[model samples]
Target: MRNTQQRKTEWLNIQWKGGVMTHPVQQDGSSCGVIVVLMAREIMKAFPNVPILQFGTSRKEMANERKMMALQILKASVFDEAENCSMCSLKKPTGSVHRFINWIQCDTCERWYHEKCLGMAKEDLEQARANTWSCILCS
Candidate 1:
C-alpha cells in the first residue's frame, strides 16, 4: 500500500497531467467527444464484458451515431420541451451535429437564440464562457 505522502504526490502528478486515460482513438479528430459518448454507452450496455476497442466504427458510422443521438435528444429534451431559437422559432438549429448546439441565451431575458440568427461572428459571440451576453432586445 502507498503511504499518504506518496498517494498525495501521485494525485498531484495525475492532476497536473490532466489525469491518465486509455481509449480508442477516432480516425478523424473531430469525433472524439462523440466517440467517448458511444464508448460509455457501450460500456454500460456491455458490462461484464469489456468494451471492444475496435467496434468497427468508421467515420460514417460515427456520423450516423451522432445523428441518432441528436435525434434522440431532440425528441426528449430537458425533461419535456426543447428550447427554441427566439429568432427562428425552431427547436433545432440548422446544420451539422456540431452546429446543432450553437445556442446562446440572453443573460437578462434568458431566451435562447441560434448563434447564426444573432448575426454574430463565432469569435465575437462566444468569446468567453463566463462572459454574460444579452440579446438585442435585452440590450
Candidate 2:
C-alpha cells in the first residue's frame, strides 16, 4: 500500500487541464479533507466557465483565491454543531490539545464526543470500528 505522503502526492496529481493544479496548503494537518472539499467548491463557484481538467490559471492566482475564500467562510455567520464536542460542549479548535484527542461521532444523533467521555477503552473502540458508529445513548 502507498504511504500517506505518497497517497497525498498521488491525489494532488489529478489534472486540471494539461497542467497539474496544486491543492491548497492546509493551515494545519487536521481537517485537510474538509479544506480540500471547501476549496474545490470555492474554485467551482469562482470559475463556473472553467473546465475541471483545465488549469489555465496560475498557482499564485489560486492561492489568492483560496485566501479570499477563507475570508468569506470566516465572514459567514452560520455555525456548525460539529465545531464542539457534543457531551462536553467544548470547542474543538484545530490547534488545541483536543485536536490530538480521539473523537467519535454517533451516526444516529450526528453528535461528536471524545472517546474517553463515552467510557470507551482504546482497544474496545478499535475493535468496534465501523463505517458508522452510534454512541451508547443512541445505541
Per lDDT, the best of the predicted structures is: 1
The true-versus-predicted C-alpha distance at residue 100 of model 2, in Å, is 1.4
The CA lDDT at 41 in model 2 is 70
lDDT by residue (1-139, candidate 2, tens digit) is: 3435834655455555676545455443344555566557767877857535433234554566567768888678345557667666665533456547877877888778767566777777876565668777788
Candidate 2 Cα deviation (angstroms), residue 3: 95
Candidate 1 Cα misplacement greater than 4 A, ranges: 1-24, 78-139
Q: Once model 1 is optimally superposed onto the true structure by TM-score, how far is the C-alpha of residue 138 displaced, in angstroms?
A: 13
* Cα RMSD for candidates in order: 15.0, 18.6
Candidate 1 per-residue lDDT over residues 35-97, each given as its tens digit: 788889888887989977555567888889889999998777643223778887776666536
- Candidate 1 TM-score over all chains jointly: 0.37
TM-score for each of the candidates: 0.37, 0.34
